[model samples]
Target: MSPGLKFIDFSIMPVLLGAGSCRRFLKTRMLRKMTIKHYSSNRRSNSPDNQYSTIAEIKEKMMKSFGLEPGYTTEPKSREELLKYQPKFEDLPARSMQDSFSSAIIPLSTDAVLQDKYINFRGFARLGRLLEDMDLFAAWCCHRHLKVPNLPEGVPLPYSIVTVLVDRIDFTSVSPNGTQDIRLSGHVSWVGSSSMEVVVWLEQVVNEEYQKITRALFLMAARNATNTAAAPVNPIQPANEEEKVILAGGADRKKQRQILSAQSVFKVEPNAEEQSLIYQLYKRTTPVEQTGQQRLLPPNCIWMHDSFQMSTIPSFPEHRNQNNTVFGGFLMRSALEISWATAFLYCKARPQLEHISDISFQKPVSVNSFIKMTAYVVYTKENYLQIMTVAEVLDAYTGSRVTTNAFHYTFSAPDPVTEVLPRSYHDTMWYINGRRKFKASRG
Candidate 1:
């Protein structure tokens, strides 16, 4: 599309999934460089004496090509006016769930609260993190209550909340007559739910130059006490790693619109062709609770243990530098794709169950390595089922393990199309298989 046509490309970041992390989206494609031929026929009217450049320069040019204004600008602020616009969201008092069931609402923070200078970021990225927080809270709640059992070797929980949007925002900052208190105030309205949307707003203020964030609202989705089917595996917090980029001026990752509504849950179905592909991976990786400790088939089946796609592959060549690993949701999305694909292969009666917060990444897959992955059936309840994923990073040449991790996925009932297909060869047989492919490095 031409720049004058649509501006949607100006926004939205395509998700890039690494082994265990989800990085933000770049403005343009991450493939081979994009080159544009800026042709001007009239030499006198158009400056014709331009220079030719490499594809790298073309990428930079593309950054400026689309008729878009630069997002960040630094108009020199007057020392007097620097105190304004310090905080984007103001703090408000929070209502408790006790108030909710009672049909009462309470605010969390107040006008006197303050804000600090925080890690600076634009809109989409900020909302993306808020969503991640939502996922963390949901997972914690699930883990505390629901626990899926008979786990095949190597699988763990990776349940998380996906960021959808910033429903509301309010900013409060001011410059008093002659005072010198640079302050910040605001609140973020967040919607949390799988199908039934539960919305909450958090009030926050800056302190001490914005180095820390103190919660003015502590909230979580209500647990389904009636459905005591399994123990919940998710906790109400983000992963325990704190990192910062040295030069962190990267574009935002993404703030996708919520596709699955708040009331929805994951469903699964089995098919033949999908069985063949995954049957090659998950035939014999069943859980073995030998000597009271749970393990994989072949007793300690590493083959079935390292088949999930939660890790990255290092480069085969010496010079290649692309290593894709970031946030956990990207990996979960990939696993869901594979889970559905694998379910079609072996399932006869039920689709598959996709339980959350049961995935664990135990190792880091470095740049340029081959990946080994596997999946297997653990157990079933009614039509809801659970499968295990074992993912590992490996040396392409020596076949040595580089990193290993595991996860458990849930699938639901079969669909109409799945009911029609005859059982594939993989439906009856089982074995844990793994493979890898070679491709050129990403530019």
Candidate 2:
């Protein structure tokens, strides 16, 4: 075995068995042993144990293992080239849930060097970094579910799978220790013509039993090779009653998303209850006197304007994906970190992450671009805080800026946090939106 490599047998077959069954079990055990040996040999050849490997180095190696070349752009250089290869728009073969099921084990327990990449200052796993892993795992599951027609050998995939939304990520337990190994498993639960919903679970072994720590739902869209138009993907079929229920839930979520989009504040006016709530909030900051004067601030409330935190990061090539654009996972990690910082400063205590919802990737960020992330505590209820984080890409040449992504996070403060009071119409709309999202997440 490779240095520091430990083989863990997860099988739990009972010892007391009939003679006929015993022979079969012994055969199975021999096959499993051979498989483990082969896997270990591959691991030693591909990725030898290295204590000095940096995260970038490990990530580059991983991309290569996935058949993606680092620093290589697969997109067509010109519109004419993109037009040369037209994508077919035909029905694809239906796939079963089992076909897309996949799982991975991160050997943090045995790999001390690798654990350093994910550990935070407090010796606990960094949730933001874990988000990156989850995003990548979801993309892998999507790829596993898709199957294209006969194409040239050693050619790139004809479709570009991109994460469009993170429906929700719920933390069911406390942050895990860096010493425990992590198991990521999931499958493509539902699919539309060109969109898919992936469900992933993060678990760790506790007393030799796997315990789920987080469950995430991601919405991905498949685009053409050039990423200019939508591309159809294989449909997924349920194999049993359990899978059928899961598929139904995904369909319901899709409808709910459509409804929410239709009722967005930007598309339609707020309902009666929301309007009343906004007026009441306005009154809290307004003085009773009719004379024209400045608004009065509530004793225990903080103005939304004062609860803003901003950070600018220079995007590097190390964070770029195969398309030469910054990876979606890196964007998510950056936004989550900044939002967590904003919440910590606002509440004057360490906030525990409860839910991450409605993360929308509007545009892609190019390598070497400057990303400006702005976060604000938009709403609060009791000890809970709803934060809205916006990421904008700035052009160094034209000095122009464009919004790239928007992320929403809900956190529970150790103590009661000061309410965030809006001062302008735009802030009020954000407050209302945050309130709605927070309520939905809690439910």
- The models' CA-based lDDT, in order, is 0.28, 0.77
Error of 1 at 400 (Å): 0.9
TM-score of 2: 0.83
Local distance difference test, candidate 1: 0.28
Residue 358 alpha-carbon offset, candidate 2, angstroms: 0.3
Please report the candidate that would top lDDT against the real structure.
Answer: 2
Q: Candidate 1: where is the Cα deviation over 4 Å?
A: 1-327, 348-354, 415-443
- Using TM-score as the measure, which candidate wins? 2
Over the stretch 79-139, how does candidate 2's per-residue lDDT look in tens digits? 3343333346464778866676655666787778878988888888888888898888887
Candidate 2: C-alpha lDDT: 0.77
* Cα distance off (Å), candidate 2, residue 378: 0.5
Worst 10 residues of 2 by lDDT: 47-56
